[model samples]
Target: MKLRQVVPWGFTAIVAVLIGNGVLSQLTARGLTNTVNEVMQGYRVQTSLQALEQVIVDLQLGERGFIITRDPDFLRPYQTAQSNLAQEFARAKTLLQNEPAQLQNLNELEALSNEAIAVLSNNIARVRNGETPSSEELIQGNQVIEQVRVKVAQMLQAESQTLATRKDIVTRAEILSAISTLGGTLLGTLLGLSIVGFVIRQVVQPINQVTLAITSSSTEIAATVAQQEHFATEQATSVHQTNSIMEELGASSRQSAEQAQKTATGAQEVSQLAETGIQAVSYTLEDMSVLKAKVEQIAQQILHLSQQTDRIGNISELVTALANQTNMLALNAAVEAVRAGDSGRGFAIIAEEIRKLADQSKNSAAKIGVLVSDIQKAIAATAIATQEGTQTVENSLKTAEGMAQTFTGVTTAISSVALNNQQISLNAQQQAIAIQQVVSAMNSLNEGAAQTANGISQTKISTQKLNEAALDLQAVV
Candidate 1:
């Protein structure tokens, strides 16, 4: 049963026990009172019987006193006794009404008392009349008084026996009442104690056990919550740190992305420059080839010029010989003309002019021969320079070809590098984005951890309160 029900029932049982004990005590008291009343009634009956006897004796004494002293006081006692005798008998009879045997005794006692009182009255009448009573009459009165005494004694004895019986009954009732009171009290006490023990065992002890279990469970839960809160706090701290690190990483990635973007742009520019260099080198090689052909053509033209100058020198040599022969012939013609006189003088002047012309032609041929020689020397130098120029042009063309090839390789390599840098920039950007997402996720995790820590802290406080409540319950129990 529940503690509440047990308590009420226990109280009710105690109340019932108390009520029963009270009722028993009351009944015992009532029985004792009735028994005492019976005893008192017995005593009253005995007293009435004694009073009847006294009255008869008083009548005898009054008559004797009147006979001996003639005192009026003696007559007064006698009259009073005579008047109260019937009342005394009646009282005795009422007192012994329940006792048939005692009532019969009282009746016999009354008859004897009446007989004695009548004899006394007769003696008193004789004394009042101044007539001396006879000895036989006094003897008869004495006999009746004696019989009254014997009857009174018998009634007294009967009453004494009744009083004794009633006393015994009262004593027995008192003893029984005492035993009942003691037994009831002891039984009530034991029963109340048993109920208390039962309640303690059935209700209080179990409640204590439950409270203890609840307290222990709450304590453990609080501890677990505290541990969880601590772990959550640590997790939140770690998450916050991680989020910070991720943010730094994201910033670094963004910087790396920018750097990569610049690198890619530089690589593209380098590739473009390489392409331009290759095109320029290609054009330079073309120009060098054209210049090499021109130099070769120039070298050929210079060789042709040297040959022509050689031819001109030969012609000049021939011309110089011719001029020398002409000059001699003209000199001989001038001498013949001088031998012919005046007619010959005009012919001599013409011959002299022809000789001067021949001389001039000779000088011109010499000068032309010198100039042709110089021209031949210059053509030899020009042929040599053209040969060197052709060789230099061939070398420049080879170098330009090599440079074009190098530029082609550099352009290809730069293009590849630019592609790689572009990819790196893209990858860095992707990495930064991924890091940002991770940072965001970490931030969310940190918030969640913080919330969890707060919840755990609250749980710890609640658990502590529960433990305190359990302790309070234990104290109450």
Candidate 2:
């Protein structure tokens, strides 16, 4: 027989039983574990506390034994008490197997207690054997016992903290689980009752609602499938874009590094050009020195011209003496010319014109002398200017050489940079290629993502429709 036909109620009963039992079992385990942990933790705390109490009691007893009896045999109980503390310590250690801090405290207490016992034993023995007990010795014994008690108390506080933390964690976990189980039980009971009610209502309701719900679920599944395909396409596109950008960046970096190397090279070339220009300027200045000496010789020629002018002035003075005699002679000639007037007039006119010509020649000579002096001065100035010009030129040449060297270095550096840039471009190309590959991969991934999203969308749509159909059934049932 089919399961639903032969034992429809059987399956329901089984599910209810399983769910109820599972929840109950989980709750029971949580409770039981909490109980066990609590018992173990409490036992440890109690054992540690009992150990501390025992130590305190033994300390008191030892003090009393020495005080009252003043006998060596009285020290026996104190000694035995010290020995018995080891057993109590062992018990605490065993109980605190998981409580390391408490066990450490127990060890310290044991040590302190033993020390007090030994001191008390020695004192009691001394007194019993005929020495009187001193007040100082008794006080010292009390102090040692006090120290042990303080340490035990501190340990107890630490253990209590640990217990509280454990208890809180257990309580929260158990309570939460109990609440969950209770909620589950309530939900299951309501659902079971509704299902029974639904069967009775189903007999009267039309079946068309079921058909419509199934059709709607199919439509939702188809829509989900379409969405998934679109998502995959979008993912593929994004992947491609990312890959392309990475390739571009890698290429650009390589280009920049190359450019820097080229610039450094150009700077070195510029430095060399500056040195060459400086050397050329030095040579031009050396030629200017020779030209300056020639200018100085021209100044001496002007000085000679001045001397010649002085000689011409002396000659003009002699000519004037001669001219006076000639004038005397000319006067006698004019007397003769008066006897022969027309012929003499022409001679007189010629004499006047000759005198005027002599005067003009003397003036011209003086002017020529002045002109020579000026020329000499100008030559000197020119020579001075030439010398200055040579120096200026020399300085300018030096500057030019310096500039040329700087420029040459710059050019060389620029060339190198250009070459580096070329290399960078090459690297960029490679990177671009890599990026293209990445983009391709991303595209593939995006396609896959789109497919996955499409699938998820389809699944979600189908699930939603199923849920809707389930809701619709609620109305009939």
Candidate 3:
């Protein structure tokens, strides 16, 4: 059966046993009181019958004294006895009213007493009137007194028998009350012990078993959560260190790329200056060829002037010989005119004038021969200087062509170094992006581990509280 039904029924049975014991005790007490009261009434009835017999004896003594002395003092006792005897008989009749046999005895005793009193009264009146009474009348009065005494003895015997019967009934009621009280006490004690034992077996033991299992399970769960939280914290720290290293590498790569760009710009400017120098060298070579041709033409004109001065020297020598022959002819004509007298004098004067003209012609031919010899010496020095100037111009044109070829090779090497720097910059940017993603994921895992640890701690506290409550319930039961 369920505990709900068993507990109430057990209490009800205990109450029923107590009520039955109380009712039985009350009934036993009431029966003993009633039997004692009836025994006391029987004793009162026996006392009243004995008092009636005493009153009858007093009447007989008073009558005997008055009849022998014939005195008035004796008559006073007789008169008193007569008055009290009727009252005693009336009291006896009232006490025995429930007993039919005792009442019949009292009636017969009343008739005998009346007859004795009448006999005594008649003899007393005869003595008072001065007459003598006969002996047979006195004998008849004595017989009646004897009959009254016999009837009183029989009534006293009947009261004694009734008193014995009432005592026996009181004894039997006391015995029955004792037996019933002892039996009820034993039955009630046994029933109460049975109810107590049943309750301990059904309720308290099962609750203790369930509480112990819950405390053990909560302890294990709390330990597992603590270990997981420690692992997550360590992982987050490692990810943060990796992210710092990636940022430093990216900064260095950008600086190298900028320096390479500056070197490429300087190389392009040098290539442009070299092309301009080659154009200027070609123009200088053309100007030296034009100057060599002009020097050759001046040498040919000086040679032609030297040949014309030698021809002038040969013509001045022929004029000097003709002037000397004219002077000798004038001298011979002057001597022949003296030998002939007056006719030869006129011919001598004409011959003297011809001799003066011939001397002036000879001096003019000598000055022309000295001027032609100086002109021929200057033409010979001009021809030697023109040949040396033509050899120096040919050596300068060959050196300018070799310098132009060296500048072209330097411009090609600078362009190749600039292309390699751009590829390194691109790779650094991709590595920085990947490191940032790893740092974000580690932070999320750390937060989840902290929340799990908090939940496990709360569960452990609740389990402790439940264990305490179970212990309190065990104490109460």
The sequence of per-residue lDDT tens digits that candidate 1 reaches over residues 1-477 is 543355446545544654454455456545644554565465456556666766776677667767666666657767888898878877877777888987887778777777777787788788878888899999999998888888777777776676567656755665665566555556555655665576457534544564465445445544543443343333433444466665664565566557556655655665565566566557655655665565565556556655666776787789789989999999999999899885455456556756866776687567556645644554454355345435544654554466466447645644654565466456555644544343234555556445544543444443344334333332322
- Model 3 per-residue lDDT tens digits across residues 1-477: 543345345434533543444344345444544543454455456556555555555565555555665667766757887898888888878877877887898898889888988887887788788766678878888888778878877876676576557556645544554444444444544544454455445433433443354345335433533453343344344456445543443343344334334433433343344344445445544554554455344445445544555565676567567767766776677667566555555445434544554554455455445433433433343333333333333433343344234223322322332232233223323333432333334455345334434533443443344334333322322
What lDDT would candidate 3 get against the real structure?
0.50
Q: Rate the local accuracy (lDDT) of all candidates.
A: 0.60, 0.49, 0.50
Cα RMSD, each candidate: 88.9, 63.0, 98.8
Q: Which stretches of candidate 2 lie over 4 Å from their true place?
A: 1-21, 24-30, 204-477
Q: What is the TM-score of each candidate against the true structure?
A: 0.46, 0.37, 0.44
Question: Which scores better on lDDT, 1 or 3?
Answer: 1
Better of 2 and 3 by TM-score: 3
> How many clashes in each candidate?
0, 26, 0
**lDDT string, candidate 2, 1-477, tens digits:** 221232235324424543453445344444535443564455346545644555555555655655565544545546666667777777777777776766777777778877877777767667767786688887888888778868876886776566566656645554554455445444544544554344334512422554465456546544644553344334433444665454443344344334434433443343344344335435533543443344344335434543554564455456455656655665665566577665445444434434443453444344334433433343343334334333433443343344335334433433443353344334334433433334235555545544544444454444444445434433332
